[model samples]
Target: MAKYSDEFKLKVVKEYLTGKIGLKRLAKKYSIPSNTAIRTWVAAYKAYGNNGIKRKRSKEVYSVQFKVEVLHFMKQTGASYQETAIQFKMNNPRLIAKWNQKFLEEGIEGLQEKAKGRPSMSKKSKPTKQEKEMSREEQLERENELLRLEVAYLKKLKAFRENPEAFLGKHKQSLPLNSKKKDSD
Candidate 1:
């Protein structure tokens, strides 16, 4: 569709509102593609004033629930897309039409938000049998190292319990500054 400036839209809308000319004549006078465009613009102008004819800079994101509700309202009331949009205070009636098309084509899943942008290049590949075996071996090694550290910790704990003063004396030089202060306290 040809993009019309806000000023141009306002001019067309004003002319249409003058009660002299109809939609088809105005469309022909302005060389618009269809009378529906003029009708949509007039309806939007009536509903939202000057801001209705202006183009939106940022796209709006509608929730899946909201889309479903809009479709449901359209279905129950048997209203046209433009009427439904006006009733729901939505700016874009064509958006409701697209949502309806998607719903019909793919059911609810079609109305769901799709991820945009390029797909990730670093997709993970499935591990081979050899790679899985190596992972298992590495897991066992990690477990063994943890068990050794645990045994060493238990031995040191037993020595500390056996002779607290001796343990403190032996490790006093190696202790942290805070630990030394705490022991002194």
Candidate 2:
């Protein structure tokens, strides 16, 4: 990827602000590979003025709390991905959408970053031979627990039909999670 200087970005943004030409013309004139870059730059400029469009020094690592807050803000404002990304000064608006998707699937824990690379085998306790041959109900329960958040709500609805008692049982109490909404309204 070509690394454009902050000065060049600023100049392009200034030209864009003048509204003399559209993104395609500006990109073609400037030999930019894609007009998307200009669009982002324009949004960046609008949100944070000069600072938003500036190239970042390094990859940012957002805390879970920050992720939750961003999700809340996006939901509260009913903002588009691009708009939320602009407000957050994020280079990619798609990231906000990804965070929202994960948040929806897994609750707050979905925001937690997993360890990079292969998972440590040492951490997992190998299941006993007898434990391996679990009953259909047990297997379903395990699978449900593993991907409860990743799968759609319809799957959970199916689980309810399979075993209404299990779905309404102490399973929820065993894995305690705080689900209180923090409304920014």
Candidate 3:
């Protein structure tokens, strides 16, 4: 499907109104795909004038002032997201949230609608100060505990080495009879 601009639609409508040529001729002259397109344009023009030639209805871009007012109302009234969306006639609560967050982060400049793209992950990935501190403390505690265990193990090993026989008891059942004979000789 081809999209016709308002300007092109107006020109075609004007030509059709002039009655200088038939619909088929006009379609051929303008390289429009079919007579149906020309007829539709003419009908729309006759019914609604120039405004009808524009694109289909779309959401109007909210002005910066409107965004500011909405934010102010939210701050003053402490309204829930649903309540605010209902009041503003906005079906998508997420849109309001996006605007509010943008406004908070970058003021009115953030309210300007941008082309859809990959959403940022910075907010999700960045760690909070409290989390960082807690992790650091936990790591230090683990290291200290490991050191304590290692010291205790080494101390036990040193004590065992000093008195090996005391730790490993002697069982002299097989003391070699030849050693007794040699000692007698």
Candidate 4:
């Protein structure tokens, strides 16, 4: 995939907006992969203007009015977080929580998308040192079990060789069963 700069994207959008060049020619000229990309850029530029060219880590922030509308919906409908999430097409509960908290604290301002970074409160649970040590111990126990089985197998083989009759049981022969004998005088 090629990473076109914001400038390159704007140029393409500008050229497309002029209606002077075919999408194929523009794509070929800029070595863009597909007409689809050019078309999308043009559409975005028309809708959002130059600001659309800048890459956003997240989708466009919900406006204060939009947030208020959602809050109103939540209040009027008495919808739960899940219901609101489904209605608004938002998947993140954290985002919903933030919005709820914001509604309670700063009202509509909290509903605005927070700056993209690590959350103020650490949400990830770290493994304790004891848990890490236990995992290591469990791994060692598995290895020791395998070693014990191997040692037992070797010891059994040695014992069988030392006393073949014990291993073969009653199948042991009394002699070669083919011996020459002299006649008695």
The candidate maximizing lDDT is 1
CA lDDT, candidate 4, residue 114: 55
lDDT score of model 2?
Answer: 0.70
**Best candidate per TM-score, number?**
1
Query: What TM-score goes with each of the models?
Result: 0.66, 0.55, 0.31, 0.33
The C-alpha RMSD in Å for every predicted model, in order, reads: 25.0, 11.5, 36.2, 33.5
Checking candidate 2 for backbone clashes, the offending pairs are none
Ranking, lDDT, top scorer first: 1, 2, 3, 4
Question: Could you give candidate 3's per-residue lDDT for residues 19-48 as a string of tens digits?
Answer: 898999988998988987677666656656
Q: Write the per-residue lDDT of candidate 1 for residues 1-185, one digit (tens) a residue.
A: 43888899899999999999999999999999899988999999999998888887665667555566567657755789998887666668999999999989987668766888898774558878998999999999966765664465557667767886786566544433211111111
Of 1 and 4, which scores higher on TM-score?
1
Which sections of candidate 4 miss by over 4 Å? 57-185
Better of 3 and 4 by lDDT: 3
Two-way TM-score contest, 3 vs 4, winner: 4
Cα displacement (angstroms), candidate 4, residue 92, comes to 17
Q: Alpha carbon lDDT of residue 171, candidate 1? A: 51
Ranked by TM-score from best down, the candidates are 1, 2, 4, 3
> What C-alpha lDDT do the candidate models reach, one value each?
0.76, 0.70, 0.62, 0.60
